[model samples]
Target: MAGILSLVWFVGSVLITPFLMILLCIVFLASIGKSLGVRRLYVKLLLIIFEFGRANIETAQKGSNAEDTSEEDEEHIEEISPLNSNATNDIKHLKTPNGLKKPNNGYVPNGNSVISRDDKLILVPEPPFTMHKTDETTDLSEAKDKCKDYDLCNIFDYLKAGMESIIEDQVTSRFEAEELKNWNLLIRTNRRYEFISWKLTVMWVCGFFVRYFFLFPLRVTICFFGVWWLTLCTALVGYVKEGDFKQKLNKYVSVMCFGILSNAISSVITYHNEENKPKSGICVANHTSPIDVLILMCDNCYSLIGQSHGGFLGILQRALARASPHIWFERSEVRDRHAVANKLKEHVSNPKNPPILIFPEGTCINNTSVMQFKKGSFEVGSVIYPVAIKYDPRFGDAFWNSSKYSMMQYLYMMMTSWAIVCDVWYLPPMQQNEGESAIDFANRVKSVIAKQGGLVDLVWDGQLKRTKPKKEWRERQQEEFSKRLKVE
Candidate 1:
């Protein structure tokens, strides 16, 4: 019994000593915002794996195609009729993927028309109204002239437009996960290429074990450590008197804490235009994931405003509030727009406070587009510092689909992902122009962010992800349709 106890103690010390050393190393390196180039090397290895997977997938596809050459040719011939061939050519001309055509003359729906699409019900306007908007509106007189006769042929264009939308929708897809161009060896992605070859299959199996059994446990430990560190450190800082020293200490602690959290997902962020970083004002960015807060906080400390959450998020929020003034409104308090605005105004008014980060979209987009920006932040009348964050989907999908996944589930996916790679661009500060309405200013800012992030600039509200279209929008569409039906 004595010998067994001795062996057990010896084994335990041997296992724990290295772990403790690693833990200390990570904490020290993360506190100073320095890495040992390990993450970059890991990323390079992932790229090599992806390249191997792509080559294997291509080879498998070529082999299968060679076996079914005659059948493939027949299917191709049947799929591409003269009309569809012309459409395909036009789609190619527009450089659209997945047979999606965004012609110079295609208009996205804006509460104007009701052409429904596939398994899902999405309404769009018929052409020439479908034409893309410009400084000058395209002459719809010819379209009106054809509609004047009220012939069956006139309705065919609507059917055609409806069918096109069904095949390749431009709107609803934005709320869903962004489709990958190539498989990233992750099962969650829409693309699956794991079965392409035996070697590829072996690699995927190994990757699964590595991610789930090895990486997941390590990441969870790091994340929990970060949370505890943040909670305890902020609690201590909360006792400090309100002064420059307290503020500086809080900022340093916050950065280090968030930096540790970032390492949990192996995030590799590339920040641009650091010179434009906001000192003290409203910082607006497109929302893609809750980690947007974590990502931003890692670089610079900011006072965050959001609806109060429970569980893990609640703990962090409470900790942050204790250290600094982060405005976390209860669900009931959120509906009081004026009260919320007042709180924001109060926070921004103080010169000593750090910049307040706000996501004006109000919900997460799929990282493919910038949706409508809520104008409340713009109405604050503060200088707007636009920060554009674009994530590389090849590394990991940073978008949080709140409707599908819970917060914990989303975090699990993020942990198992290869890495969270993103670029953050801090744009020049903007102010609402004299006489410019808040909505217009919001849109202008949204456009700048969309352009900077290489995302589609959309006018649709992201809240439409779960909610129905507004009654006012439906009424506007009806009004426009009634006017179109009447003789002008």
Candidate 2:
């Protein structure tokens, strides 16, 4: 019994001592808001492994293709006969670049169709086919006269475009995960290259164990302790008198607490143009994930505005509200735009309070593009500070698809991924021009962000992820079709 007890005690020490040490180190670094350069080093190591894996995948694919070519040749010889020459020609004529035979309808295959990385057919419509329309319209008889002159071939363009949209749409793809140019060895990523080589397989197995078993536990420990620390610290800070000292303490506490939490994902953020950081105005940014709040909070404190949520998000929201002037509206209250605007105006009127951080896009995008920004925030008439955040997909996917995954599941994926790497840029402050509409102002800000971040500027609303396209949009498309038939 004595020998068994000694062995058990020794094993426990061996397992627990390193974990305790790591915890202490993380806490110390988080408190000081410093890093030991380990994250960048780890990223660099990953790039090397990824390069090796890519080489192996290429080599393996070449060998496999050679074997497949021989087998295909033998099968082709057996399947064909001298009398089937015309059938073979017919087959070749039907073949498309996508490797699928086109339907036997009158629609001719067009060059405008592109095959995206995910094997989806992307139809690049002609610019004149856009939904935007002018005020000019012709009389019914005049339109009829033009329709008589319309070329029959033009109708095929519409048919092809419609079919391509049915296969895959431009808007829906933005809500999905962004594809990576090279595989990063994460199973969750879009590519599956781990099985191509034994070296990659071994490396992937080790990485899986490290991420799920070691990194995940460590991250959860840091996050759990960090949450409690934030609650306690905020509670203590709330007791301080309302003055500059309190403000300074609040900022310090927010940065330190959020810094600790961000450490949970081993986040590596690079901020540019710090001089343009928001001081006393409405701060807007493109949303990719809930981590955007944590990322920005680590650098500077901002009064957040969002609808109230429950569960883990709720705990964080309640904790934050304790120390800062955050606005969390109930679901019903959110629909009252006037009330929300009044609150926003009141908050911005106070010079001492931090600038209210708002994500005007209103939903998380896949980080490849900036969707339409809601005009409500721009209508406030305050100096708008635009922020752009772009994540490196080669590291990990940062987009959150709420419809498909719950908050806890999303967090689990995040915690188990390699790391979160992103860049934040603070562009120059913008204001709505005189006589300019709110929508135009919002579009102007969105364009600036999309340009700076090298993201595609999309005019589509982000809310379309949860809702169908408005009925009027379909009607407008019909109107455009009628106009297309009009020769002028």
Candidate 3:
């Protein structure tokens, strides 16, 4: 009877255990979904709160600054005005850039000059006026109609205008009307909706942390799924959104897995000389666009060492760094002059992670010519591998082409343009022997890069080649010094 009971119990345990395991898995996945949903909701709330607060603060600050500026302008006007008690009656001609002459004779009660009160001159701050009310229902036509009456009014009319004259003067003096075209270009580049969406998405993902204690396990699951979901969303959204090549590439990678293509292409193109690869050395390349980072990472030529923007982005990069051994430098930390150099030596000395890629051109340029290379990257005693990249005509005007357009604008240009292609040329490794200066090494590498990429004319020699100088600066200076010495 005891043996029969034991057999029954064993059978029950085996049957129940599998059912329990399946139940647990279902619960875990459900909890994860719930956690992610909550986090996203929280993020939206937080963004709304922060945006309202920021807008209020900005508005207040701008108001205060304007008041201060108005007071200062009043003092300046008084100082500049010629001493004639009755000069206010005499029509004083004020010459404007557009050849519009204004009578500056009337002094408002507050002692400010009167001018036309168009929205461009008064209510709106500057070009591409962003001060328009978000609500379309708010009618500004009445205010605009009142503005035209400024021509008929006297001193009292000018004083009634209040900040209008001040706003106009500030806008005219500090902001050029001609710059509106460029400002419009900037607006197009940084598409408002795309930027806002990205920020909100990032925020929503982070909001889950607030409830981590109760939802820790679920949060982890949510994170796993949310990443792929967000990536998909961002990709679809980015593809539709206009931007420059780099911006589009970044958006494509972040939202979808399309970046893998760019990576594969770069890896295939960059010379992979296992035998010639330096055990450890500085890898220097031309800065065409920010996408250049993606190219370097895909090539597996050098470990990235730079500031890490924490959060999901940080986690993704950190995971990649683990495989590639990335060294993260925080922006807040004081830069140790020798620290990076020493680190490079250590990494190169090791069997793993031999090459460190550096963009010696400290900042991004239009890619028409190579900018002056910064000296620090060359200081690492290892051989320098100079890489030069040239974009195809399809991307000529989009990639590292101009500062006038934003990332989105550039991307749009790329989409509309012909097939996007790039040429990557890697020069032979440069070794620094004893007593070699970083400048000399940089110049040597620059020369090699110029020749390989057909960009020699863009370098210093190009200037000398066109419009030959009669004498060098040193020679001219010496000639001047000789004459001075003779006089003495």
Candidate 4:
């Protein structure tokens, strides 16, 4: 019963569709003709349709007679061979070697059947195609409009011929402009527009206002309160407990709190860590923002090693130390680079401290690409664990462009968007090859993280960021201007 109704419905639709289309077409043509002041629109539309039909007909007839072999055209013809009909009946299965699924008795597959024979089976290539030439014509009404504007001057010139010379200079400029207004000569195949500085300035100003109004309050409410909470908990725990166990416990608590803080900003956070990997190995990860530390800490307990930046970010770093043994080194103490390396080794060597965490990319990258690892981190040569950090910019960019945005500004940008999210992969510990220099080992580990993190591997050494390029315009080099210097 349903089938009969469906068939009736289908037939009724088919019969009524053409009539409805015809009515719509008449109304459309009447409107077009009314606007154009003529009923000649049909002629123009039909000509366009005919031109399209002719092009399609030419293309369909391109290679239809490819195999013709008349004696007059024999010079272009080549010998042809037909494929054997019995070849498929003799096909063999690959599993025959294991005696599990035998090929059809006495039949075997021949892979050579797929190979094309150029001499014996020469197929004629299709003829080159040409596009239909257009019959388009430009309207001349604009030129008439220009003449109307000039007609007023003509009235004055006829009254006094000497008066025309006085205004000739003004008239000539307008005439020259009008003459080439519709010309297509010296065609611009491509356009190269130089930077418009004013537009950029306007965008920056607008962004600042947006951040201040929309995102700043939410970020401060979350980050400011969250930091104080972490500090209070860590201070309470750090002072009361005294052993290596206490520090590990503090790390575990810090990781949990920070992880929750991370979730507050991001919609999703994906963490992948190898179960059997050691808990206290030195961790080297890609640097995107300060949040990289928070995100990873949420995944596992790790003691952070970094330099303190001035402003709110610096204060957050100091507070983090109360939670666990976080090492904050100063670059000005170049004499202490070696000392810091020793401390990192000591932390990893000790049984009580959480694993040492270091972002080899000293500065924050936008997370679209990776920066080079500091060779100093690799010098420790302990069982090195590489952790890849990646963020989805769909919610908010994870990069901290310190030059343009302070920590306060960046945090607001992050929270105002959808939740901040990241993927953390604790890759296998890199096995240092014999005679491998510290630089090579660091690069090798860096490559593993970049691959696992799904990021572009860069050759830039982040450690050199302090001295080279001067720090005045560092954000440009990191994001926009250094595009040419990027490694594939």
What's the TM-score of every candidate structure? 0.84, 0.82, 0.40, 0.51
The runs of at least 3 residues in candidate 4 whose Cα sits more than 4 Å from the true structure, single-residue gaps closed, are 1-219, 276-278, 463-488
Position 174, candidate 2: lDDT:
80
lDDT of 3 by residue, 1-488 (tens): 99999999999787557645533543453323222243235435544644543344334435546665656655645654554433322222121111112332443221123444434322212211123345767566543444333233323323434445453332122111111111111122222212234443354344334233223333333334444443544444444434345333433333223233231121122333334443346678776665676554433435666666676457555544433456777775417757767776776666444366677765554344564566667776666877776554311232443335565455444333222345576667887767878877777787677667755212232222224534674475445334322311
List residue ranges in candidate 1 displaced over 4 A: 1-15, 69-165, 189-192, 485-488
TM-score of 4: 0.51
Q: lDDT for model 2, on a 0 to 1 scale?
A: 0.78
Angstrom error at residue 176, model 4: 45
In model 1, what is the error at residue 141, expressed in angstroms? 8.4
lDDT by candidate, in order shown = 0.79, 0.78, 0.45, 0.53
RMSD after CA superposition, every candidate: 5.8, 7.7, 23.0, 30.3
The positional error of residue 469 in candidate 4, measured at the CA in angstroms, is: 7.6
How many pairs in model 3 have backbone atoms within 3 A of each other, for residues 3 or more apart or on separate chains, i.e. clashes? 11
Q: Candidate 3 lDDT (Cα, whole model)? A: 0.45
On lDDT, the stronger of 2 and 3 is 2
In model 1, how large is the Cα lDDT of residue 318?
94
After the best TM-score superposition of candidate 4, give how far the Cα of residue 234 lies from its true spot, in angstroms. Answer: 0.7
> In candidate 4, which residue pairs get closer than 3 Å at backbone N, Cα or C atoms, i.e. clash?
92-109, 265-419, 265-420, 266-419, 266-420, 267-419
**lDDT tens digits, residues 58-158, model 2?**
67766767565656655554464242454344333332111223322322122112322222222323424322234457245543454455677656656
Candidate 3: segments with Cα more than 4 A from true spot: 1-280, 310-316, 395-419, 456-488
Instruction: Name the weakest run of 10 consecutive residues (lDDT summed) in model 3.
Output: 176-185
lDDT measured at residue 299 in model 1 versus the true structure, 0 to 100: 92
Candidate 1: deviation at residue 224, Å? Answer: 1.0
